[model samples]
Target: MLQEAVDNFVTSIANGEMERSGGSRNTIMAYRNDLGQLCSHIQTLGITSWPRVTHEHIGNYVRHLRDEHAYRPTTLARKLAAYKSFFRYLSQKGVVTTDPALGVCLPPVERELPQIMTTEQVQTLFQLPERDTPMGVRDLAMLHLLYATGMRVSELIALDVEHFRAQDAAMQCVGVRGNVRYLPLTSAAMDVLDRYLQHGRPHFLRDASETALFVNHHGERLTRQGFWLIIKGYARRAGIEALTPHKLRHAFAMHMINSGMDLGSVQELLGHAHISTTQFYCQLASAQHR
Candidate 1:
């Protein structure tokens, strides 16, 4: 019966319930998976029914996810969100008297000031890409756009050829929440992109109908894992430890803020819906000057 309830909940998520409510396919799947994990954990507690699960049981499950599963804080936060939503649904249906996941404080997440590369470090990293080869040209373009636009890695990989306004030297980046914004590219970045499009992309193109701006060797759109490997390789080659694509984004934000760009403009450029999110870079830039 417990498994039946869990399966029904997952089915609801998969059957357009969440989709109609603005949840993406990825998001709905993630919630289903997270809740499934929670249900599995509950079974281990010898509880066969949802009503038998107490608030304390949910707390124990959270601790189990943290200690035994070694889930990261961000991941844990999402799992908690899933738990809350699921329990709220159960409560509304009279399956449970109260929301067990409610009033449960999340583990504190450390908001570390993002790491950023120095201008010299960025220059060194950019030089490591082998521009003589197709893959090299592609890497150069990806890396250049990463730093030039401060876009999230997901946004970078999702870009299509049409997204680039080559005449204006800008690219349109799509946010996870469906917000779209244009990011201006540096002349140097634009030059590398032009070279990659003309010389590199055609070499990797296996399908004439593919529209992804960047493609892997398999001629498919690049994945986040693939880009992570690429960035890690270049960072290692540049002799920079702990550098990530996100650090490049941080570098872009810091550089812009330090170069006298206004906070509102930086917020817009970074596609930050909140000014508070962009303010952190200002603090990072201030610390650098100090």
Candidate 2:
């Protein structure tokens, strides 16, 4: 029965249900890893099915992850979140009558300020992508768009040509709950996008019907992994450490605040559902000024 539950979970992932539910591949993999360990632990306790698992079983599993495996608080919290989500999924499908992982206590996670690149570092990264070649031009546009819009990499890759309103100098992105937010494009980013469309994108266009704003050599929409590789390659060339999309996003917010953009404006531009989420960048901006 343990195997059956695991199989069902695997099937859900394979069927693209997770992606349809707005889960990224990386996130789904992390959930899979966390739940796999929990299933293994449950099997040792003579529990085979999710229906037979009780809240006590889940509580012991958390303690085991904390005490026996010496998992850090953040790791423990993430694992418990995966367990709760999995049990909730099972309950919804009638595989379990009750969500055994409900109301489980999770370890506290200490918040850390997200990492960001200095202006000098960003300049170096922007200069690393060669301007004379198609791939380089594409990479440059991607990097500039990321920094300019503060778009999450997921949203960045999901973009299509129709999303951009060139006449308005704006791009509309689908945010939470299918609501759309239009972000004004900076002159520099707009110029780069124009160059990419006119010169660079055509080079990669294998399919004339492809609607993706960014495409690989095969003319398919760029995947998140593909974007990560491109960013990491440039980061290494720029001699920057620990650079990521989230770091660039933080950099965008902090840079905007330093440049006198108000917090509320930045929140709206970033499509943040909560103003408090945008306020964290204010904290970073204050720290930097100090």
Clash numbers, per candidate: 0, 0
lDDT for each candidate structure: 0.87, 0.84
By summed lDDT, the worst window of 10 consecutive residues in model 2 runs over 16-25
**Candidate 1 residue lDDT tens string, 80-109:** 888887887677778989778878777688
lDDT of 2 by residue, 1-290 (tens): 77667667766866766446556566768877888888888888887777899999999889887898898888888888878878877877889898888888964677777667888988888898789899988998988888888888889888899998899998888875566889888998898889999889999999899999999988899998899998888878888888887888888888888889988899988888899988888887777678
Model 1 stretches astray by more than 4 angstroms: 16-22, 63-75, 107-110, 174-180, 235-243
User: The CA-based lDDT of model 1 is what?
Assistant: 0.87
Q: Best-fitting candidate, measured by lDDT?
A: 1
Worst 10 residues of 1 by lDDT: 16-25
TM-score of candidate 1 relative to the true fold = 0.83
